[model samples]
Target: MKAINPKTKTNWEAIGVKPHIEIPQTNALDVAYKMALNEVKKSVSDEHQIKDINDKLEELSNSLPLKEK
Candidate 1:
């Protein structure tokens, strides 16, 4: 009597998450929020996500709401 594991599929490509995913939008009160996010990221386990967050901060810093004539 031989038993097969359902998790061990012959074709795994079709079981994983979908490709071409879209990221969610985030809102912050001000630069303080970005700073807080950075601080919190130090404790997280993921590094790639942290880098994405840091890049987001850079974008926010570059954007300006007020314009000069």
Candidate 2:
């Protein structure tokens, strides 16, 4: 592993290695992070909802009268 220093960074333009590719100013990593965060939040919310539904079902089952065979 090598550490990259800003002062010793290679200049792609000076080396005549100009790539025709155009990069967007937007940070893709930040976008991905935000998307992942949102998914985690949604998953947590879904878990809570499922737990609440299960708790309600248990209560309902307990309130029902048992039938003898």
- Highest lDDT, which number? 1
Which residue window of length 10 is worst by lDDT in model 2? 60-69
Question: Model 1: per-residue lDDT, tens digit, 1-69?
Answer: 334447864443546544342223332254455666778888867889888878886776666342223
Off by over 4 Å in 1: 1-28, 64-69
| Candidate 1, position 30, lDDT | 46
lDDT of 2 by residue, 7-36 (tens): 867454445544343233354344344445
Record all residue pairs in model 1 with backbone atoms less than 3 Å apart, i.e. clashing: none
Among all candidates shown, the one with the greatest TM-score: 1
The local distance difference test score of each candidate is 0.58, 0.48
